[model samples]
Target: MWVERYGPKNIKDMVGNEETRISFLNWLKDWKKGSKPAILIGPPGTGKTTLVHLAADELGYNLIELNASDVRTKDKMTQKLGPTLSTHSLFNGKSLIFLDEVDGMYYRQDRGGIEFVQELIDSGRVPLVMAANIEDDKKVIKLIRKSKVFRFRRVVPRLVELYIEDILKKDVAKLSKESIRLIVREAKGDMRAAINTAQSLAGLSTEELSSVVSSRNLAYSLKESFEAFFNADSQEEAYKALIASKVPPRDKVKIAYLSVINSGLKGDTLIKALEKIGEADKIVNMIGTTQEWRLLRYLDRLLAYSLFNTLPKGSVSYSEEDMPWNLKVRMWNEGKVLKDIGGRLSKFLHISSREAVSIFMPYLLVVIGKEKKSLERFIRLLGLGESALKVMVKESERVFLKVR
Candidate 1:
């Protein structure tokens, strides 16, 4: 990928956020035992992770990096990080502990993970650094209180364009000035995305470029697409909006369902809107189950004309969905956890993982949370850590209340 191929090699080579980069380097240079850990927070594709890796190289520190995928149970964290906190490197060099995406720690599955890291930061021998996409997350807020926080803002479009231009020059590739402008504008300050788009357009003819640009420029985020669909003035406009959206058809239907239910559309309108959304959802599921992709074209009309037509007229309004970065990260992590839970339950029940997850896991969690003894027994049998157990208990409680 261009993102990796053209990634910055050193601190000075990075683009934008020059002040924040200097702050990061200064923090590293002035590091001492028990100095507050420096946490770099920003949006993805903005070079936060790259800066840390570059700074570690430039400052001659041996870096021990951990990302969100690392199991962060208390025991696992202690076992992996304890020695790093207490001892110098074997080569007699400084060691830096860099935790990337610290915002992914779900309170249930990462119980005590943050606290343990905090303890290490307070009195550890090695200098520590962390990175997360969002600063306002509750876990990140807790991290900020004990750390020197440096925020990496999005790289402005001009800087991103310059970086792309330099790369294009090196590749001996060419694009129309208009194409470059379109790519930079559509990238919305994401340097990695801008570079990737430029790379993909490297060899296309100018005539072909406009169509690609138009399609890409029309790629609204899930939230933006839903907003456009709800606020569109005509059926044709709504249909065009849905067709332009980059979200998959299945997820598009879900977004429509959530938007309508949350929009406070009531009585007959609510019933009609739900009926149309349900029909679209069924078509999406059928396509998934049968591998019949040809059915996808109908989804646009169904969602746009059939479903959106039920909206009450004259300024339908609803709050934007609160799909924060941390929440999306948490949902992904939860899916992985659920898959693991399903695998374990499948073996015990002599069923498939999908069956265990879709059929058995919900009820199992409810039963486990309701009966303390069952919870303990299952934890021991599954070798679940405190974090996983907490997740199970919380999910179980939710299921219990819904059923009741």
Candidate 2:
């Protein structure tokens, strides 16, 4: 809710990206009288929504907002929103219709999604505003061309900390500087995240939080969580983090498997790790496809593999051609994106995530060049990047050049 509470109000409170803010301000001035809707594009928590509303408020305009979850049928668009959108004057007298996370529509791609907005722009009734974490990639060339796009960048750490501390000093008077440091550092350049981190820590421990300037979770941080779970001294800690980690069992298994493997685990111990992951995946697949609720027990088994398993195999090695840092980062990014793509694209099609991923991922991973570019765009839209996305399948279009 920090995003709600401290989200930059009136555009000026927003930190970073002076040019973007100015561009948006200029667009706001002439958006009516036939100019197309303005689009705010950027990463999540970058204040896209905040900027839009602040602009509207500063300009004294009434806001009507819609998200993908809304029924945006052509009939709905043309019949319902299309009328007042233009004829309306400004703020009670002036009104702006806002569509947020516009790319998050649930309907089929062919169901007039991008086209619907284009039609609305062509109508030119209202000065519209759109907020999405996207940019013109090849897949949406038309949208890229028609809208006046503005980018929002992440709030830097120093400014974010200042904002949070200012709010905290008012909301709760006793927060220590150490705690403030942790909250700011953990925020990872996200103001909302920073606020939430501060809030979470404040609730848990009153200790003076420190270590903000300290080197923190590295590019390879998630792997450490893997090690913590699989190599933990107790199941309790392992169980807690695993259940809470965003990683699903398939990758949990793979991550834990790879980490254990890296530590020189082999033979029965190695097989044991594989078996645990295998079971986890089996159940995960069941949940994905069959909606089998009873299979939840296997998710626990995966955590148990990390927690309860004893005397991990393989002596941990340092010099034996370690996984490259870039590759590791890519793999992690791909895992999240693939999993999300599975779930999200499925919803858009009214299919299951399991089926969605199985159907589309192989194609994306195997194809290169333009095809890869399109898939990559989709990945960026969903806010995912990584290596868990694999070139595991062969596509019919071209033979892939194998790289070492």
lDDT agreement with native, every candidate: 0.81, 0.63
Give the 10-residue window scoring lowest on summed lDDT in candidate 1: 315-324
Please identify model 1 stretches exceeding 4 Å from their true place.
89-92, 203-208, 217-404
Q: Write the per-residue lDDT of candidate 2 for residues 3-34, one digit (tens) a residue.
A: 56655566777776778988888898766668
Residue 218's C-alpha lDDT in candidate 2?
27
TM agreement with the true structure for every prediction:
0.56, 0.52
Best candidate according to lDDT: 1
RMSD to native for every prediction? 12.4, 12.5
For model 1, what is the C-alpha lDDT against the true structure? 0.81
lDDT of 2: 0.63
